[model samples]
Target: MKKNYFILLFILIITSQACGVSVKYSFTGTNLDPRVKSVQIDYFPNNAVLVEPSLSQTFTTNFRDLFLTQANLDLVDSGGDLQFEGEITGYKINPMTATAEQTAAQNRLTITVNVRFYNNIVEDDNFERNFSHYYDYDADTQLIGSALDDAFEEIIERISQDIFNASVAKW
Candidate 1:
């Protein structure tokens, strides 16, 4: 009887595979529809009043990498099951705290992005909104070289994750 049960189980597995039965799994806490097999991220230009030369490309690339790594979706040029398009709308640097001598002690860099997300499979999931985040540095430090890189890394990582949460994770 045990030998017969083993044979039946083997046959069931083979039959499922032959029928092309498959299950979509998500290890990233994603709620993406199985039919959403591809995505397109449009180039996000910097429309900020305070323009950073590299901000546009950096944000776009980082945003694309997030979905590629987490969503397991194909990158397509157009007509994807899921699509993201946006522009950088705000980039501002301001003093946050002041020293006793009336000098600036800390500064903050804030970036705002306006995103338009489309989910063809789930129309209710589509959205257009703005997301913003910031990074703080010492007032004495100039935002250049590694400091700028670090700020971009921190800011973009946050914004991209926010985008992922909104579009893919449904959070």
Candidate 2:
């Protein structure tokens, strides 16, 4: 009976402290300030020399979706506590490995974006930098049809995750 009383008392103390803590915790491993309740993401235009027409829309949509799915913040059009704006700056394809016949064995597609993050609640969290990710495909297959679509999806997912981690995950 004495041991049960101690365990109950310990749980009560922990629960009370949690309710009073200022730091916010999410199941997604994000530590967001309670004061920051909303975010705004501007359209990210694809400005790469090798442009893919659909890239701009796809990337921008995915970027916004990630934050909404991962965090508890509401999405806003402008003047949010957290704001993100950027442009897709680079998209390049290059040969990776060489085959025995001196032909391309793998091709790497790299996508880079310049991201600017603003935290109105915490000025120190604001930053502007580039985030990039790549996907490699077998040289025998052309980067069209399903292959190209798959690559774009993978690259976009990685880059968005990186941006999220840098801006809010505090990793």
The best candidate in terms of TM-score: 2
Instruction: Supply the TM-score for candidate 1.
Output: 0.86
Cα lDDT tens digits, model 1, 1-171, are 999999999999887774443335599868876777999999999999999999999999999888889888999989999989989999999999999999999999999999999999888889999999999999999999999999999999999999899888878
In order of listing, the candidates' clash counts read 0, 0
Evaluate all candidate structures by whole-model CA lDDT and list the values in order. Answer: 0.91, 0.94
Superposed model 2: Cα runs more than 4 Å off: 1-15, 18-21
Clashing residue pairs in candidate 1 (N, C-alpha, C atoms within 3 angstroms): none
TM, every model? 0.86, 0.89
- Model 1 Cα displacement at 153 (Å)? 0.1
lDDT per residue (tens digit) for residues 22-67 in model 2: 7788899788889999999999998999999999999999999998
Model 2 global lDDT (CA atoms, 0 to 1)? 0.94
> Best-fitting candidate, measured by lDDT?
2
Error of 1 at 1 (Å): 12
